[model samples]
Target: MRTGILSEVEDMIVDEVPIALVYNGISHAVMMATPADLEEFALGFSLSEGIIAHAGECYGIEVENGPGGVSVELEIASAAFMALKERRRSLAGRTGCGLCGVDSLDQVCRPLPALAPARGFHAAGVRQALGAIGARQELTRLTGAAHAAAWCGMDGVLRIVREDVGRHNALDKVIGAMARGKADPHDGFLLITSRVSFEMAQKASLAGVSALVGMSAPTLAAVELAERAGMTLLAFARGDNFVCYAHPQHLAVDT
Candidate 1:
């Protein structure tokens, strides 16, 4: 430790690049995201943003790397492409702000899928998943700046983890990975390494995941919306402890 002499050193940072999502050769959105998992990001963003109903609707994905930014090409079904063209939501996401480019309230709360009724998850399982997630966050370990989203089963097994500079991007990546892996949305709960936001809850609901747990507190709006979507919202989740903001019926305390 030098006395008042701070030394400049290079550190491994999370790479944030502009990823343009293109559908049928038409640019739909350009988001600032971590460079890895372009295909998963494409698929996840498409599904989460309601661009495509399901992963099968996306025929293929192409990642074009460039000096400027990466372009993700999604060859989606004609029906989905037409829907995207009609909706025409070309968002330029700066960070994880879910409603960055939304112009009006009507556009803000778009239609979401009907999430099934709440399924019980053991308290011990949630605690185990929460405790295990820190070790699974590779990028957070590397850069300490990225957020992570992990899909944990009802039994509390950490199934998959994805990271990005943006929390929304991380969650989207997890959802996309789940879609590609054919993981049943009904079989698990999603845990995010960030606060619970309305859009985050909305995304989970759209994917039909019944539970959302966050490392930080939930916003009032997030809890309200999540309640409407039939999700069990838990936040401020620490070792052997968490606060359930909504739908406590779904959280079965392990005796």
Candidate 2:
């Protein structure tokens, strides 16, 4: 028996597929993600995961669809490939799980470089980006289940936006797109529609992004990481209100 209030209706849902990041014929990790902007995801994951030091070290990337799922094969410089092998561990990724399949605790936190101080950032710019980003999120508008990551100029212009079933994947996609486009990381801020976590902060710092803004609160670990990295971290950002978690000095208050 069907309830009167419940009726069958067709609905659109976000797609989450298994994405394998294969390096030098070695399967390194697998993640659940939306099958869009995958090339950027691959590049971003590589850089953030420290698989390669720079984009130039990545010689090529190939995406293959198979019965299991999509596999992103990356060809990188021998040096980088060697480093990857040394730290090689299979990651059994789940949606939004940043740390999975790590064999030991030692690998949990990798050392990161201190970020250069961000400049020209204002609270008003954060508000402006927050207001404009919703309109640019096509996937979220369609599926309502996708998370978004956007690259925004200090002036509050949304330059690039990427969406995925997993927040981390979305961040990786936008970071990859930014690198592929040769955008200077220091010149802009990263806005994500997810809580700021340690891995999220780590990835942004690795990309040399000086500022990271989020639509939700940040974890304590994330706050500490951002503080040490000298990154300006903000969360719980809505129209005109936001909480600064780290390096508030970098963000100028708009009068």
Candidate 3:
């Protein structure tokens, strides 16, 4: 179940495995991750990064465990394949980390496609969603070393949640799950247990999520990105109080 084990003591070190994402027969990135739910990992990584428009665009996903590590073979739409080919070619996936392989400004500040206007949402719904997300993190309860990304509808019911040691990976897993389930992104808001950064904002926008709620503070760049993407950004989501960064109109809070 783990890699390194203590002989005298009885503690297990969590296993880390290298998982590669291959898009249309061409390898794109190799990342060190917990070797579980990898099929979901591959889908989440692709959907959150804008490699495919939706799960329908993803033809198939295959998982192969080998001596080197795990390889996820993803068959995507022709247009996505071409776009990936034109973009960056190689990536080294670090452990549960974000923006590890990005070495250029172009990649960091890529323009996002316009998003739909945000619909009004009840404040209580957002609060209930956050509570539900906290309750749904089974792995986090076990390991206490993972982050969770979740989806909640306007009614405040959390429908989906994914956990990973890395913040980005968690979000990616959620995105992939949504794609595989063929869920509509416009139907809900995304809640995360990590800080809001530029890449996080990028992924949220790519998923067409109307609003992003984070338990931690957001970077200036993240706020700017969310504004451009027409998504609302909320930070410091503790209890019933939060700081709204963009699109405050969507928040139906009592004066």
TM values, all candidates: 0.92, 0.92, 0.85
**Candidate 3 lDDT, tens digit per residue, 156-177?**
8988887877888888888888
* Candidate 2 lDDT trough over 10 residues, lowest sum: 89-98
Candidate 2, which segments miss by more than 4 Å at Cα? 1-4, 89-103
Taking the tens digit of each residue's C-alpha lDDT, what string does model 2 give over 23-122? 9899888899999989999999999988788999999999999998999999999999887776553433334444653445677777878788887988
| Clashing pairs for predicted structure model 2, backbone only | none
- Quick one: best lDDT, which candidate? 2
Better of 1 and 3 by TM-score: 1
Q: Which stretches of candidate 3 lie over 4 Å from their true place?
A: 1-14, 88-104
Task: Per model, state how many residue pairs clash.
Answer: 0, 0, 3
Tens-digit per-residue lDDT, 182-202, candidate 1: 998888899998999888988
lDDT, model 3? 0.82
lDDT of each: 0.87, 0.90, 0.82
Record all residue pairs in model 1 with backbone atoms less than 3 Å apart, i.e. clashing. Answer: none
**Judged by TM-score, which candidate is best?**
2
Q: Where does candidate 3 clash, by residue pair?
A: 30-93, 31-93, 44-176
